[model samples]
Target: MKLSRPLVLLAVGAVVALALLAGIAYIFKLPPFREKGEIKAGEVCSSLGSSSNAVDALTKVLPEESSYSFDENIDLRTDVTDTNFESSCFVAGGGKQLLVAKARLMEDESATSWTQWVKGTASNEVSIQSLTPFTAGDTAVSSSRFAAVFVPCTSAGKAPGGQYNLSVSTELKQEGNTNDAAARDELIKLAKNAASYAHVKAKCDMAPNLGGTS
Candidate 1:
């Protein structure tokens, strides 16, 4: 039996409408398409979140007698992230050092999920030496004189999701004789201290092995 012309036209219209709806749904599912909140960026020398928190989380790990400078010498270049919070520090004395800390308030991220993000970020580097797992978070140390540690945390001691990444780079002065081994150890110390933040401890416990290059 031959279908009427009007009936065939009606069928085609229905198919077109369904396809358009599917496209819209897919767009909304992407990260960029979702609602975005304001991202705050500042260059304060001390304090983490507010004025009362006297301790400066970013520079707490540096060695004693090392003077802290705000955004004057360090350059993150292409590694900069557009997250909710970010801080950078440059320390001089024992050696010229650069440290960067970044945080994202993800509402739905697991240890496994954030681990992948960190690994993916490091995969493209020239050489990745180790990716060790620890109680607080996973640490990735590269022979390139750089280290990154990622710790899962909460936004404000309230659960949902929060994750942070701390990366440090060490550069010896032209006439200095410090070795990379000493600098690498210092970087690890910084990472451990950063993970001790109240917000990080609130969410991070004896985290399970999330498998990385280590």
Candidate 2:
């Protein structure tokens, strides 16, 4: 059967409109409204590197008065899986002092949740004398005059169901001018900066404590 002129014209107009919309979308790179996720978390990180920003983050924490610099060879590495991401960097300063800044990302599951503060194991060989809370994470000061922090990145609102952990360890570093007190302070500051840069939540009022006496 032959089609009516008006009906054929209407059909042609609809096709042209669709084609024009498609061309506009392609030119402007406009994604459809019903893409996938709601673009939650603003921008979820993916290109977190090991030596790139990790080294800068670690170096920024070093005390200016201390005679320390990143060794000629920095032992830093990073890894990422479907459910986890981690970055670590080793720092050397004052001839015999060492510090490590590490960050971890994992699914926001109950068992491995990053919100709570967990104490580290301490024994004769590994003696964590004090465990306290920092503004951005947990702090542990060891008997060997060591300092560290375990931070969970939960400040960005819990939309994606994942958390972040930023840990700093100075247990291996020998006694130097920068004692546990100073090292602990530095680590806490580092954590605060990390929270801001990485868009994580931090509890600054939780100010770190030495747990025991002072």
Candidate 3:
């Protein structure tokens, strides 16, 4: 059959249109888009370690005798509520990626000077299934692990009494296969020292008491 020039043009246009539609479909078939959030597990760990080092350097600048420690097994929990607070960040090699999680404390209704809005907001950020609850002595611990870039915190000006206290506790596991009470005690002591140093730094960062009798 003999084809006219107009027919050839029409066929070509149809082929082009089909190709364009296929390209568009392929683009739409991609995985659901998500915005990238800050630091991975490895990065967070490095940052936390770096922060500790920075504190040490700062202490050297001071005239007072300074001795600080770092807690390897830190437990974070909330005093205002029965629920515990925990977080962990780690990076896996191979095809697996890194994950960083930040768990915030929840407020109990019975607790005094508690902020409901802040608690609600923090709860929303928590991944419930990932959270693991544990207890040490009389204290309750809650922890969660995730892949994140930044540590989440309560929104400014939303906390109760314009203050939010985060308590971090740490314990040391056995060095080898054997779990000894003495080793555990030693680890706790080191962790307590670290926690004490961290508390001082936190207080300074939050509010510096400049006006006091020297």
Candidate 4:
């Protein structure tokens, strides 16, 4: 049918509008849309090794109305197995993967470079002072966008070593510098909470250092 010019334009506009809505839905992980991928309770700590995570549900850590809540969906892209697990979680904001947390088991007593905290304790590099919050753990680190904890996991890990280490990493995309200090401190706190969560779930031998909650 040969429609009038205005009518043709109106139809085109409707299609474009629908496409825009679809794009928004596809880009942002809107609530009630991807119910199957929802992050249930107690999932955040173990999210480093599982598809389910606590990021979206960590109101205590990320805040209920934080800008991160408006970011893209949670992506759990890792290689985990039934016995051993090594996984990472990321907030895929604007196509940039900002690591939120990664949990893994390691037997490398001399392993370093995983995080600034690990590197600093391993060596006395001059720039080691840049490790923002040095009180995260026995070996840990923190920044506006990073926090990691390496704890004794004699009972937690199923790996070969009778005694090993449990590592939990946390970071986020830095939106601004106005609150960098507070952000670094908060990340350090998050890392502590995450370490505790994993310790209990994984049946670790000892509690995390975490600089005694500050």
Candidate 5:
């Protein structure tokens, strides 16, 4: 039987709409479209929507097209946040890659270890060759493509000297570009921003006199 003109037109329109919908779905699956997201941990980082600059800087490690996500768990005691953190709120432009992580400064050993490391590297005392945007905080440090910002905070537990377990820190370590001041500066921005997110999370208020994060 011959179909009416209106029926044929309607069929054609339906086919077109289906095709459009399919195209949209396919685009979203591609990395550039699909991988453009960060799992926000809320508070300061809530505003950390996917876009450019920091994320672009961070994704420099990815040779191919890239995407990113942010996470919050950090432990300074074991240095897991810096050395082993699978992800970060940090974004960098290192030749290879970079990461941001959080940790607690609960003891003198860790404090000395972390802070001294930054001071030495930032001052050029050490030679892995990192530069600085160098945002100052309660105590920040630098090393071979490594930077960490420490925010003062106290956890519930007490320390050996009757001190409270304190500090929320972020480490932005790049696999390369240790000597590029501009790149280091970007990493500093990324690190500080990540530290700020942690500062809010930690509820750090112990040293407001020392100029806490904004």
Candidate 6:
């Protein structure tokens, strides 16, 4: 059968259009977005160590008259097992004692970071802070002292496609008894403890999720 040139061209055009449509459909049907990993509850506390030692260390550095209180628990959760936790403590006789901590985890091995501020305290409050992305031994501590407005997240990572974990801790002090060096030391020690605790919790929760196999 001899087909006219214009008719053959038209037929060729239709076939090309159909093929393009099929390709588009296949791309969309393949799930362009990967499913977010799942994070199970109760994973946050699986390997949390005792905070008592840290608290006791802080007590040694604080003034004899100063009183302290600590609270530790999971605060937020996502469907993918990414979690956040907070550990706070308050000191009396120096305004309101406040400590805050937070963390996040992902199923991917990629790095990530997040920052949060201390709440329920004075707008202008003294803060002591520390953070660890990998190990507690590999930490960065601040030298000079000053009032902080917001805590910042510098670096972060994620796992493959499973759950991830994170943690944050903070200690806040109000201006009082400037001559009491011991009080300041105690506050700083407490803040360090909070940070350490948060780091440990994050590692424990996200350990199983590493490599996304879990």
- Identify the candidate with maximal lDDT: 4
Q: Which scores better on TM-score, 3 or 5?
A: 5
The numbered model that scores best in TM-score is 4
Candidate 2, residue 20: Cα displacement in angstroms equals 91
lDDT of 4 by residue, 7-92 (tens): 99999999999888877876674532432333344434344322233442233334222133222222232222222435444554
Pairs in steric clash, model 1:
none
Query: Which wins on TM-score, candidate 2 or candidate 6?
Result: 2
TM-score, candidate number 3: 0.24
What lDDT tens digits, residue by residue, belong to model 6 across residues 1-214?
A: 9999999999999999988877776665422322322222222122122345444433443333323443444543332234343433333432444333333332222222222322223233334333223222222222112211112222333333443333233333333333445444443444444444444544443222111100
Model 6 weakest 10-residue run by lDDT: 143-152
Candidate 5 per-residue lDDT, tens place, 1-214, comes to 9999999999999999988877886776653344433422332233122234345545432223233344333432322122111123443321333354444444323556655554543322332344332446555554434556555444333223432323333334434433455445544555555555444444443442223322
Model 5 residue 174 lDDT?
33
> Each candidate's TM vs. the true structure?
0.37, 0.38, 0.24, 0.51, 0.44, 0.37
Taking all chains together, the TM-score of candidate 6 against the true structure is 0.37
The stretch of ten residues in a row with the least summed lDDT in candidate 3 is 143-152
* Candidate 1 lDDT by residue in tens digits, 34-125: 33221123443221233122123223333333233434322221211322333333333334443443332233345567555655543234
Candidate lDDT scores, in order, read 0.38, 0.39, 0.31, 0.51, 0.43, 0.35
By lDDT, the better pick of 4 and 6 is 4
Q: What are the per-residue Cα lDDT tens digits for candidate 3 across 1-214? A: 9889999999999999988877775675422222222222333232133444423322222112112222232345433322344433222222233222222333222222222222232323442223332322112222232111111123235455433433333221112222343323322332233333433433312321112111
Q: Lowest-scoring 10 consecutive residues by lDDT in candidate 1?
A: 168-177
Candidate 2 lDDT score relative to the true structure: 0.39
- Regions of candidate 4 where Cα sits further than 4 Å from its true position: 1-83, 94-99, 108-129, 155-159, 176-178, 211-214
Candidate 2 lDDT by residue in tens digits, 69-158: 432222222222122334443445435435543444433333233323222321124324464544334433323333444544342343
lDDT of 4 at 75: 29
lDDT-superior candidate, 3 or 6:
6
